[model samples]
Target chain A: MLIALLWYLGAVIFTWALGLFLLWRIEKSGVKRWGATGRLFTYK
Target chain B: MQWYIGAMALYAAFLIWTNVKSLKMAESASDFTAGGHRMGLLLGTGTTTATWVSVASVLGIPAFLYSDGAAAIIGWMAGWIFGGALIPIVGYKIRRPANPARTFPEFVRMRYDMFARRSFLQALIGVVMFIGYLFLVNIQATGFGIVFSSITGVDYKVAIFGFLIFIVITNVGGFWSVATTDTLNAAVIAIGCIAAAVTVLLSTGGLGNILDTLAVTTAPINEGGPALDPGVLLTPTGSFGSAALLSIFISNSLGTPSSPHWVARMLAPMNVKVAVLQIMANVVVLLVIWLPLIVMGLGAKALIPSLPEGVATDYVIPLLLQEHTPVLVAALTLVAICAAAVSTGNSMLLTCSTSLYYDVYLNLFGRTVSDRALKNWLRFIVFVVAVIAVVLAIDPLWFLAMGFTYVYGGFGATFSLTVFLGLYWKRMNRAGAYASIIVGFVAFIIATAADVPVPFVVAVSASAVACLIAVYATKPPPLESYEPFFEAEISESTKVAVERVLKLNPAQQSEAVEVRSV
Candidate 1:
């Protein structure tokens, strides 16, 4: 049970962290393609 | 009844308010069709993720897992991963077209440079997309009816009608409203699914207990057949057999890129880089959101080993929430389920409307309707499509996931080769495109009608072969015809030379043009 809990926790954390990192990189690069603003919240 | 009404009322009010704001921003046809191509990565990611995680993912997938086991994950989720990997290739390449198409059918027309203003191919693609959206909308309505009836004891008919009205109203603002509402829906879904998963895991004695229970629970193969080992449910080929599993994988993975709703999301991203990121992020979001539902489904199997005789496996998650979770959590979960339906339904409706207005009415028929008139036509189409979907959804023909799989296979087989080769293979011509679409669609239909065991595989293979043969046998179109795709591939020196020559006086430029023509 503990192992299962640990595994689930590990997977969730890893995915969230990876997603955040990608979001951050996109923001820092400030490179817009097509029309992308690199912003996560705003459409423009 | 009061709770259901109150929840629905609040949801409707929020949607209407948001959509009105979006409508103000959507003054032009471009804004209505493609969110003005201003969708940042965040908004794009949110909308795309929400669109992908339809009611099927929220409910149907879990139901499948509860009845079948972990193998359902491979059948459903594996295809998504494969599809996600292919998205960047096609999405990035197609994003920067010389003349950007508002809809996929329009893209097809522009890419192929078809002869007739209303080419047969454009009309066929539009009709297929409309039917596909119709099926998707029906799925959402069916899901809404089931959830509402189960929660509030409302008649399925009333619930579906209420949902239809709300969906159509929200979509009145077109792509703007859909994208904004989708972002909100994505957030709600993520939170709701995660919360449900945590509650189920903690309450149901964790993942280990669930797996152990599932290991021993035997399910009957048929009404009179012997009980099969439930352990097989954990395998890639569950009791459904290997052939069915392979078909599910092929249909889900390959057919995804062809889905007009998903393709619409791809078209909204601000840039190629953002488009690629959005695709990657979608995979991650799917993993995050799906894992919880998977655990919940497996937990339900352990907790409720024997459901009421008439109750379907699809109801497992909702029943689990009602039976085990607190009132607030259960209500929120139900809302999330509805949100999933709404987000997907609205996106599908918008795509269908765009295809009809742009591909069929304007381009194919060569209508010169004013922008305002076109917008009104789109809204009217949305209402008509919603009504049709509601009528069909009153008696859904197939199980949610399975129905989706059939449509997905057809679309994937039809468009996969065309989109792939159209972007990458310069030699691919109009004949190849036509052959691929026609042969692929027909092959899928025949295989399905004939009840071929692995119809998707057969359909995709046959379509690919036809496409390749057609491409090789026919002469390639003129270099100018390929310019939109290959221009980006031009060498820097060649580009500079061309620019330098164009900078010359008209006489010199004319001479250069004559030489090039020669």
Candidate 2:
């Protein structure tokens, strides 16, 4: 149970980090051109 | 009963009074719907956070844990990050021009044409969303009944009426009142959820006891998918597996950015940067709320192995709190649960009322209504929606979880698509916007009625296709047809206000400039 619990917590933390990291990498790559189109905030 | 009912009533009265004060401050329809477009960053963030917290976070997430194991929490929380992450970019574009469009529907109308704007398709989409939101509101009301019943031993119907009356006070005050109350509700929820988390952990006799109990009685992870393997967490495809994890990612990322509550939140922020910060605030809140829910859920698993099926799994958290925690701690958690339900209900009722009064009634009947009459009509619409929600809450089968999800996904996809595409694809015409509204809504109705095995995936997939069809089917109108839409309504002097929102840059400024020019 503890292992499963830790795994659950790790997955959430990992996802959050991954999302932020991806956002950073996209910005670093100057790939804001691929974000949601026609709206403001360039990443799409 | 004494603590929960008394505290909730007092809080409800306080919220109504605050909302009324906001109503007194509102001087026009724009002021009513958008809080005079002069909201401070703190209040703006507070309102956005409060409204978006909804039952999904409060009850639904905890319930998911009980049923689907830890994997369910991942899916629910992913939406917050996805939705929040994507919004700043959206906000930076929309806040600049400060055009007169009040609702997502109005944006669709402008980007498409009157046929799409005022068409049956648009209104029908609103109807589906309203029904879904209404069902969600009733479910929250039902939660009130459950909380009240758990403590006081009163009938569920009585609790429903008491809650309905409490919510009605805000209707007269309208959006301003909803915002003020929602901010207060958000505060209450943060404190209550954290407190409940701590107490539930202690009551469960700590991590040692929790694990000992789980070792003895934990159900097999799945019938065929590796029985009782805690290592299911190691493989992405184990018990909960990677498939469930990916589902969470897809649903939250695609679904949340499109929610009406979120879009409304985007509208409330003082500037684009503030809106982006608001999304970050959502991430913070998710962390605070979900951590405890996950712990408590695991505790519930260790303590009570059997919860009745088909009852919304979200109810398990409160049920656990009521039965397992001490009386004092239980009462506080009850308030938190009620606060969660009310937060979403109040926001939904407010948003739905605004849509009916501003988007539908005003669009259709305002031409015949005097200004004074319109104010009365707005108040009336608020009352009507609240009363209908109350009745539905009491009626068995009036509320369903999936109903709300489908409507939210459908309407969100429909209007959000128009707003996103219109801003970027200069070729997305009024014709396409109109078609999207019709097809998006029709697809939603079909999905809602169909008993498909995977309704969420089906509804979203079908809706996306509808949006693309709408976009591609019509030729873009000549540049002249869209010229009026590009103009900025904000005075040049307001550039300082715009500049303060740091997420935006000069190129983004040109986007707003394009909105003004179109």
Candidate 3:
């Protein structure tokens, strides 16, 4: 139970951090037509 | 029966409000379908989250958790987070100026070619999605019967009929109505789930006490190890195992983009930025709502030694809510559960109805259907489909989770590949598009019909492989024919959407448009 709980916590934190990091990079890359930051949210 | 009838009345009132509100706002076909692109941030977030969670998450996830333990919760969350991460990259990217298509079918036709192949692909997707969801659809109906019979003194048939009437009423409002109600439903689901989870967790003491009790009560049923082992719930890779998690993430992330029902909601977003933000917001909301149910399930196993045979596990949450919680909380929780079911049901009915009216009736027949006429047609279609679903719900044999997996998974694999490739790769032509659809549909059927070993994996994998092979085998469309479809950059509204959401300045945002034409 202890080992599985630790692993679950680690997986979640790492995945979220990784996703946010990718999001930051994608924002910086300006790969799409929108500006680096412009790609993040829908600014209606 | 009282609880069941109470749920029905509440749902019916919600439907009347939604339909009356929508009728006042709807002025054109676009308004009926996309709510005139004015849906706000909260509504967008709430509806998207609520609609996607469905009975699959509400019932299936908890049921699995009760049987398996905490590990199941981890596995389920892993799928949601991965799917959440993937959506912004693809779903948002596709909504730009170069291709502002409202529906998934339109995207396929534009990105690929508008011919026999794309049409066939769309029809195949429609059929599979409808059939795939039938299992859950029926289960939910059966659930209604069970809940009603247990709560009220009345017969089961009344509960079923009441549910059907509720389905028809909300469904009549089309996309506009569904979107509004979905937002309300999301709130209800979140509150209901949290309430149930908290009640169950407290009733059984803390997590430590629950585990302590489980330790003695649960012994290894077999040499296979502890029957109560929490490890079974956690897939390898810390969360759920990679393949299972990946299957979930890929299937859902891709599926939402290509789903006619979901993208139709996107069209109603006040702007592009709202759509992207809503997807992110949905991630948070889903976690909050689903996590508690998992905890409740695990707690249930510790408290109740064994699950009763022949009882559908999906009702476990409701059972706990009714058994353990105060009367008022139980009532609201029932509202929440019904909210979860009705929100998705409304969306499904609306999507199927719109497809019948716009894509099949008008487009195929080439009839110049008026907007008012189309709305009426959509209402009629909803009524017919609801009646059919109600009838199917009466049958006990319907398997909701597996059925949804085969049907929805197939659609996601086939259409997503076509949409992504067609948009980015100009080499894809009409012939290739047709080939991809034919191969995908046939492969899906073949994989599922024979109960071919590992149907989900086989069907999804087959469709994916067929798309690539078929594309490579076919000739490209003429360059001249494809050129008009390619715009140099995305639309201003779409760019504004990207810029605002991504928090980009005007000059920095221009970089995103660099590859628009290419």
Candidate 4:
């Protein structure tokens, strides 16, 4: 049970951290490519 | 029971409010179809996840996992991950054109100028999209019927009517309403799936106990049947033969970029970056949620070794929640299932209506309706399609009984090859596009009717060969014909010269120029 719990916890944390990091990288590159006029950072 | 009713009542109220709010904003066909291409990352991510997950993820995956073991994940989840990766490669390029087409058929028509106006190809594509959405609607209705009937003891037929009422109300406002409500639905689904997973995990003594139980439990066989092999369930082959599994994986991953509903999502983002990120978010959410649900499926097997003999496997998730959780938690979980169904249904309905109204009704029929009139026509088409879907759902064809593999395979075979080749390969012409769609579609139908073992692979392979032959046999279109798709920004001289060379009618020339300037 302890191992299972740790595995689940690790998987969830790793997915979130990795996903957020990739998103940040993509957004930074997007802003560089198109600048503020592209509305990459703006919400609606 | 009362908690379930209360939750549904609250959700219905929320749907009604969103409909009213969005109806005010949805004044043009563009807003109704693609939210005027101004959707932000937050809403785009939410809708993308909500649309992709569907009831298939919430209900179908668990059912498969319950019957087959962890191997089901390879066929379904792996396909999703691979398909999500292709979004940047295929979908991003298609969306990057200066004058992005509003619908998939429109995109095809514009990209391949041979069928740009008044062609059978556009109408045929629109019909296929409409039928596909209808199939999706019926699937969502079936999911609703199962959850509603199980929870409230209402007849399944009666429960579907109740579900359809909510779908129609929410979709009356079109894409804006769908996107806003999808954000809320995505949150509900994420939270509810996690909560249910945690509850099941705790009750079943965690993932370790569940895995241990699954390791020993053998599937029961009827008389005169071969004794079941427990080993196959844990491997990638599972009950499906290896060839069939590979075909399913290819179909799911490769076909997704061309599915009309998903293609519509690619059109909703404000820019190419947002589109790419939205798909990334979908992948992450799917990965996080699916693992827990797989665990829950194993946990259910451990807790209830055998369901009642006649009970369908689709009931596994709901039955698990009802057995272990408190009334309120179970009720909330059921709401989440409904949200999954409703979200997908709304998106499919909007896509279907867009295809009908924009691709076929207006474009093919040569209607010069005003913008306001077009919006009204779209709403009416939505209502009409919902009614037909509801009637069909009443007698619901058990399409999913055959597995989602076939459906995704059909879409992928028909559109994937054409869209990918058309965008990347300069030699691709109208003949190739037509041959790919027609041959792929026909091959899929014939193979399915004949019960071929690897229908998807055969269909796609045949289509690819046909496409190659057609491309080589025909003369390539002029270099200027490909200019719009290749260039980031069209020069004034090139636009004027191309428009004159194509000899587009006055209306089309102006519309093309307008899209370019936007």
Candidate 5:
């Protein structure tokens, strides 16, 4: 039960980490592919 | 009963008021359908999260956790979030253009067949999108009817029709109204889920106690639910094997990014940055809501081992609230869940109508419609679609989550590879997209009908293979078709061409026409 519970907890954490990490990939991949202006903090 | 009536009335009134405000805001067809492509961070996140949660999250996932145990944590919760993670990847391409298409099918016509004479692809996309979105509306309406009927003692069919008024009113205002109303739904969902989590914690002491109870208890989750195996409830996959879990996860994760409703959301934000940030907000909010549901589901099993006979696990949350909690908690929870369903139903209803009006009628049929006229006619289209969805949902399905998975799976199987290849691959053409949609959808329908354990996985793999083969066999796609997605900075000539297509009605794009009526 503990192992399975850990798996569930692990999945939740992984979803958060991987989800955020992918967003970072979009941010870091450059201005060429995605046109990200590094302007997440300020709105136009 | 009086509290139920009052709370339900208040919630509906709140939704109607918010929607009415949008009626004045959406004066043009573009504003009505796409919020004029200038949605801010907060509203974008609110509507996307609220729209994505649906009945599947509010009732379906929790019901799955209640009956099927831990497998749902992987099959649905984790799998669905994984799908959401791919949003930014798709968002970057779809939001690249300043003047984006309001609907996914229109985008497909622009991207895939900009120069074809009467594109079969656009027509196919419109028809498929119409049916595809109907599955979602049906699921939402079904869940809404069941939950409404239960808490208020209304007849199931009657309750469903009564709810249609809310859908029509909410959607009649178009994108702005839906966004405003759905933002409110998002807030209520967050509040109710957290409160429900607190109730569960106080009732069962803590996670440790709830887990310990499950370890010892062998009783069924409910009379109609599967008999519990003492050890199974705590397993990561529960009754599912590793292959089964992985297959289901892949299906959910990959398919959602390409689906029309989701792509339309990514297209709604003002720019790539807002689109990116809004999806990030969606991921966080969904996490907040889902974690609490896990606690409540396990706690309910620990607190109430068996419900009355003939009651399905789908009714666990409602029954749990009725038996164990006070009236206010129960009412808030039910209203919150119903809000989740209505938010999704109207969103799908809106998308379904767009498929008909923007994609099928204006594009495929090549109707010369004025922007002002389209703004007025779209509301009638929305009303017609809502009525059809209501008719399909009169008899509710048994498993809300399963119903969701079926539609989502079909969408993923058919569109996942085509959408991805279209965005990234220069060689992708109408032939490739056609092969993928036809082969993948056929394979999916067959696998689903056969009850294959990994239908989406098999279907998508088949789709990919067919797509690759078909693309190479056909001539390479034209420069105009691939420029917007592939080139970081489109060529000057290509920009004029792209803008020309964007300005013309999609129906008129296929051939040269001197008369510009749109």
Candidate 6:
């Protein structure tokens, strides 16, 4: 009953689009301003 | 064989180049473990997708699809994609601390230690991580051995040994090396898998012809096997039946986000936004790998009517590359499978070793051990575990995917709910956290021993119930415990406590972390 290529394809398209959407949000959040500036960890 | 060897040499050279480059970049112990928490979008996406494309994804899923037909794909896609959807939730919550933990044990210690000396808890976490991740390391070894042997026509036992060298090199330069090499591997995997899928479609005359062949074929997978099932491959339930199908879906859905290394990857990103963004980015890229795998799995069956009597179903994809596809396609796809193995092996090896050395060992002694000594200790453990894992996969007991059910289920039941609740539930006290793990782990053991159907689902459910009950029964956690996660500013005392743990101070309550003279 769950076997529908068309339906699975749609979900695929939606999630693909979702990834790009969130990525856009990240750009808007000023990714450049905070580039790799997180506090670092060390063995010590 | 020459093509396979040539491509492998070139790939190995590039990987080594990255390894040497990363050696210099890992200045502190932190850089070794989490890439200095500086992973940008490209490397972040690459590592996530690479680690996610485990041997199980390439070999296991297709093996099931090869045998059981269309039903398997539905189960995997449903569970996996849904699990993929939750990455942001898990990532955002765990990365909440102003100075978040570099390792999983550190995260737990900070979050649930009333916000700071739970040695027993850390030890327990370490033990679980070691056992859980050991299975993962072994799974990679198993896949690497089979694929390498299949493509190169080498003995499985002999071929598997090369995996140890691969992992040691991958683990040598630490996380930066792992991420950089894995990024290269990820691109190769994506290209290889897609090419294999397109070739399969062309060979089978398209999906319609495949379904038609599967509809009436009663050919047994092995010689002289039960030859009675016709039209079952196209049937909704297929050969596996509905119960087994549902179980596959449930385990994957519950297990993916709950997998410790996946959450650990989130900690490596530049910030919480990057953490969330990486997973969101993963949805598109990971799907690129997953869709083709589904095609290759079913298409392999259509191309090769039935395998030899003794051959394992895991050989489906490798066999497709060897005989049916064009020389270039075969070489690339097989290399892709190899890439998947190395990609996963690097991370799992790191996690498994860290659990043993950092989490369990340091917690048992004390937190005062210097990072310099511990780094040496960690590398030693990586080599030791690689050898042990190779030993563990000596003989194939069942299909590759079958083993995942136990380990993933164990992790899911034991740690999944506790991790989730720890992140979201401010009321979740230490007692509740303890109860969840003890009860959840015990439930998984009992359910697995009892031969319960989809044991993970039952155990996770039990864990959830226990977690809730214990949290209410115990006293609420102090402001320190809940504040760092919920409030914008961490209390000064909590901040000092974090600094102490990070600095590796000798503990008063616990034993000293002195590396005593041998």
TM-score of each: 0.86, 0.78, 0.80, 0.88, 0.92, 0.90
* lDDT tens digits by residue: candidate 1, B314-354: 67777888888877777777888889989998888888877
- Tens digit of lDDT per residue, candidate 3, span A1-44? 45434544554454455445544544665544322445454243
For candidate 6, list the clashing residue pairs, or say none.
A41-B30, A42-B30, A43-B371
Q: Please identify model 2 stretches exceeding 4 Å from their true place.
A: A1-44, B114-125, B207-216, B219-249, B308-312, B366-372, B395-404, B444-473, B478-518
Q: Report lDDT (CA) for all predictions.
A: 0.72, 0.57, 0.58, 0.71, 0.77, 0.75
- Give model 4's share of reference contacts: 0.03
TM-score of chain A of each: 0.66, 0.58, 0.63, 0.62, 0.55, 0.59
Residue B341 error for model 4, in Å? 0.5
lDDT of 3 at B291: 65
How much of the real interface does each model capture, measured as fnat? 0.11, 0.06, 0.11, 0.03, 0.28, 0.10
lDDT accuracy of residue B314 in candidate 3: 63
State the lDDT of candidate 6 residue by residue for B46-135, as single tens digits: 988899888888998889888887776666665666667666667656766666677787677766763334367777887888888888
Give the clashing residue pairs of candidate 1, or none: A33-B271, A34-B270, A34-B271, A35-B270, A35-B271, A36-B270
Say what the interface RMSD of candidate 3 is: 4.9
Query: What does candidate 4 score in Cα RMSD to the true structure?
Result: 4.6
| Candidate 5 per-residue lDDT over residues A1-44, each given as its tens digit | 44444544565465556545645655575553243555434334
Please tell me which model should have the higher DockQ, number 1 or number 3: 3
TM-score of structure candidate 1? 0.86
Model 6 chain B poorest ten-residue lDDT run:
B509-518
Cand. 3 TM to true fold: 0.80
Give every collision pair in model 4.
none
* lDDT value, candidate 6, whole model: 0.75
Candidate 3 per-residue C-alpha lDDT over B1-518 given as tens digits, one digit per residue, 9 for 90 to 100: 46546765776687688778866655555556656556677877877887876666676666666655554544444544554554554544454443244444444544443433225444444555555444445656665555555556456666665567667766666666777777877888888888877887788887777766655554332224445443443333323445654454445444545555655565556544455566766666776886676677767766655555556666566666667777767777677766666778777776666665555444444465555677788788777777677677665554344344544556655555565566567787665565555566666677657755444456556666766677678776544324433443445554544334222111112222111110
Q: Tell me model 4's lDDT, rounded to 2 decimals.
A: 0.71
Error of 6 at B284 (Å): 0.9
Q: Pick by DockQ: which candidate is best?
A: 5
Q: Regarding lDDT, does 4 or 6 come out ahead? A: 6
